[model samples]
Target: MKKVFTIIVLWVAVVGSMTAAEPVKLLTYNIKGHGMTDSRLDDIAAVINAQTPDIVALQEVDNRTFIGIKHDYLSELAQATGMHSSFFALVGSYYGVGLLSKTEPLSVQTQSFDPSDTSKDKEARGFLIAEFEDFYFISTHYSLNADDRDTATAWAINFARKSDKTVFIAGDFNAQPTYRAMVTFKNNGFSILNNTSAYTFPADGPTSCIDMIISYCSELGQEYDVAETGVVTSVNGLTLSDVSDHLPVYVVIDPIEESGVNNATETREMRLVRTSGGFSLSSLQAESMVNLYAMDGTLVDSHWVDNGEEVCFPASCRNGLYLVQVKNGYQNSTFKYILNH
Candidate 1:
């Protein structure tokens, strides 16, 4: 009997490890074409190497354009960092956005924006979608004009809604948090992964927050939890401001595993509702271990609760985004909630 119990324990451990998912690190930067000189390429590559990101999205890259130094910026950067490269031209096959990955993407696609709705004075813009094993990574740059930004936001959201897998959209949006484009993303079930409080523009002396990373998962109760995120101000004692006008933003995401439970059924059975003071859970089928976490993966509270129980935030808790996870022997579910006074 002792030997049989020992064997059972080992089997459970193996199964648990198999079901666990790995975290993915993503970086987004707007490297102005003027800053891509031969001398500065090493500094930019060093910053990327220090981060060790699995994938990178870049904007304003040049590809042997006569207007610039006649150098392929994307190719040189990829060679320096030992990564595969893909570019989509937004301006006459010369200047555009690009993507670099440690592993080659399974597929690539591009969408061109229609300039009909945009102002005549604004330039054309578009996005690139790189499909990997588990998710789609989109690279984009929005117009500086408010109306143009609004049109681009609507187009991107429509594309994301058609995807069946998790989607990550990152770029220099050229709009602040208070802009309508940002609000549309929030209202359409997308979550901002980077720290919005950290300003990323005019890298020399930043004052406004324009660069951003946002994510969306098609399933209702399924979402990627943010493990870590920040704006890269400096790397290896080299100030990044010397490399570009916009700082790079990165986010590490923990993908939720979909193995042992019926996600569609389990999510439908559980509900999270907000009340006047706090939140409450209803329709729970079993005794659950409830855990609440802040946006940065900090466990704010944990406790055991039965059906129709209320979970109150600590008085010191500020107004921000929070996650609620409820787990039991047979089922597990997670939900996102925002607290506002």
Candidate 2:
């Protein structure tokens, strides 16, 4: 009896160490070209910082198109949010989909899928997968056609199967939960997070739940347990208020240390993504002063501005990283951001 009790205690200790309770946060957002102007990257970062997600999937990204003012929104995002960014160019066009991770991903991979059909106007659809410590994360925006979605679904499942690790996918499917594409995911062991009937598009008035977070863990050497999942609504009274056409979705996964990948690659930074109407800072009081400083503690710019105003950084500002300090009386807040040109 004494030997049996010792063995049971040993087993319990092993399992307890294998599965830590700290959950990993995940978020998905379709930022509508990540906002219209170059300066808006900071605003988009603000939206992401507010969520404090460990990983994020984004769709409808503009790399460097005719109308896109920024040369590489991905790098700017990396600067703005200080997250490792990856992009998958769809149809060889400037527009595409991609992902960002709080931790430097172990690996990044991308593949184009048959969208059933493609025309000059319709860009090809694709998926980007990032390898983290224990699980694999994939991001893809599905085609508008039923046949295309079916094709993408099969490809995604095969791709996930390539790795024995648990896999989670998040993006805008452009289809309802009852669609055949979703059914295929279900049949292949993928389950949608937050199956509640909450809509995600048409930011002013959402009517359908097109955005989804799907996960698959099974007998093929996969293991994961979800802590919680839900839709991310707007940040009240901030620059990101009503920022995009669709609302973001998020999830928290338990035992994040299972695979021995520590996501603490860097310190968390705050970014302010712009709203459709433009940036708005409701937290600052009237007569607040703003100062921009380099990481080396060199004062670069200083100015006095009113609250709820959009302060666009001049193009002449040297590129790299900067510390943005907002001061009102004795209260002050500082933020770090990358400024890759």
Candidate 3:
């Protein structure tokens, strides 16, 4: 009887271990030219570091060459946070979008709407699409032109519908929810965050709610939960500041798992260290499988590293932290490490 009871307990443990809850956290911000002189970058970094989000989407990222400071805003943040990042210039010197993730991306692509027509300024602006393990995410800044805005909206929907994976779309869309473009996108499967009327732009007045985030399922049968959503609000009674005439939006999502409850365990004492090739697995045990994923939550690689095994990452590995998942039988663990140049 004791042996049978032990067997039952072990079975339950295995089932629990196999059930892993990996929540993907996302943030969208329009950091005004990296907040050049206001010292807002420090505040922005503080907020991001505190959230420790898995992915971040940024708009108005500077790419101008003449800027004496770091011209690549996203790259600088990626370096500061040890996360992999990508950027797309929507308007060259004026508007751009960026994606930063702690996980390595499978592929990065950019698309610029029709630039031939000068009337379509926003359409001339481009968007960046990032592919992670089982999901695809995009960021953009829409054109202020109404026709271009509508066209851009349609273009985004068309792309989302054709994607083979789950999608997360975020950026400064420049259109209210009441706008036809916003409505049409919602009619499809996109669920927007902050529907409760959030004030996002101009920083001071009451005109918020344009900067937005929305998500859609990839396949016909899969399910998703909005989980949690909100504005970054203010830290120490100070708002996102006048950095870009916009505020930051954030959302956390839980993708449905097939078997048991999906919950994450608290990761304590987690630290990322630079490594040649890649990183080493220290204090990890044998008989455990490890999965390396990009910030968009895409699995880049998986294997079994022997207990206390140290393996060098591939040279082509980009600079960023890789989400490391360690699983033994039914129980699981997660950690992150950074790669630097």
Candidate 4:
């Protein structure tokens, strides 16, 4: 009887590890590139690799511009990451949104919304819908205008509802959680996966979780789970947002059929040297004004320091995400780091 009980316990543990609750990683990045250099593409690809995501939703892309990579970004990223690819040129063949997937999607389509009632100056926006083996993976970018964001999301929600397949959507919403589109989405049975206060804009220092993910599994409540949602901060020691204005937002979705509970994960500590004296900046050869901003883009504090000097936050400073900007009269550099309380 004792041997049988031990065997049962071991079997359960092994099954749990292989459960669908281990979400396939998904990432959304706005890679700011109406015209990007090859070196820039490499930098962006490096950042995406650090996370090892299962799929990625990318925007602000330029595909094969004359002076650009001279190759479709979808193909470039596929080559860079060894993923399959697709694209929707919202403006033209050169500029639009794209997707990179580790597995071949069953079907793919891009839908452009009718903005007849929207502002004329508003840019044309679209969404990418790729039918994966398990779910409908979607992507969109909302308008900078609050009202337009509502209109765009309304269209996207309508598109998503057209099919009953489990839907996983991601993009740069431009509207925060408090906004109307977001409110409507929440009310209409959509769940923001990484819907935390973690901001992901102005990569120099994010203040809003604009880049986001939303998921809807018809049986999610009964047989599925969203394991984790977060912002991807850095690659190597260099900061993102320095390359593009927005950081990557990610989500992990797991399926749970048996009686199961959510698994908690530890927060990843960013690799930067720090102490009680506050964190020190990397070596620079210039005297600079080291300005710090809260995740919401609020200027928390600033200091004048010589090159390679260590700057400290106030004693009253609380813990969260903060961005560091080092400016000399001649040139400026930005760095983003975390402050643990």
The local distance difference test score of model 1 is 0.78
TM-score of 3: 0.65
- All models: lDDT? 0.78, 0.70, 0.66, 0.71
TM-score of each: 0.71, 0.65, 0.65, 0.67
**Top TM-score hit:** 1
Query: What is the C-alpha local distance difference test score of candidate 3?
Result: 0.66
Q: Write the per-residue lDDT of candidate 4 for residues 61-165, one digit (tens) a residue.
A: 787654654576568878999888888887756777889899889999877754446565357787889997668888777767766777777776676666656
Give the lDDT of residue 305 in candidate 2: 49
TM-score of model 1 vs. true structure: 0.71
Predictions: Cα RMSD each: 9.7, 18.5, 19.4, 13.2
Angstrom error of the Cα, residue 207, model 2: value is 0.9
Stretches of model 4 off by over 4 angstroms after superposition: 1-22, 65-70, 117-121, 219-223, 258-341
Taking the tens digit of each residue's C-alpha lDDT, what string does model 3 give over 1-341?
99999999999989886666577888888777643642555566666776778988888776543354445556667877778988776654444778899987899999887644657452466678999877888888877776777777777788877887777788888787768767777677565644325567777664758888776664542344455556666666356564456777876666665444332331212112223234433222124577888788987877764321234555666889777777765446777767675
Q: Considering lDDT, which of the candidate structures 2 and 3 is the better prediction for this target?
A: 2
Worst 10 residues of 4 by lDDT: 263-272
Cα deviation of 269, candidate 1, in Å: 16
Candidate 1 stretches with Cα past 4 Å from truth are: 1-20, 64-69, 116-121, 220-222, 259-341
Instruction: Tell me the lDDT of model 4 at 173.
Output: 83
Off by over 4 Å in 3: 1-19, 64-70, 92-95, 115-123, 220-222, 237-239, 259-341
lDDT of 2 by residue, 1-341 (tens): 99999999999999996654457898888988844566555667788888889899999888763565547877788777878988888845557897999888899888786544453326588789898877888888988877888878888888776766778888999888779998788667676654335567777777888888887753343344455555666675553434678888876665422344333222122223332222223323234577878888988877764422345556677778787787766446777756655
Best by lDDT: 1
lDDT of 1 by residue, 239-303 (tens): 77778889998877767656566464454345565544566554454558999899999999998
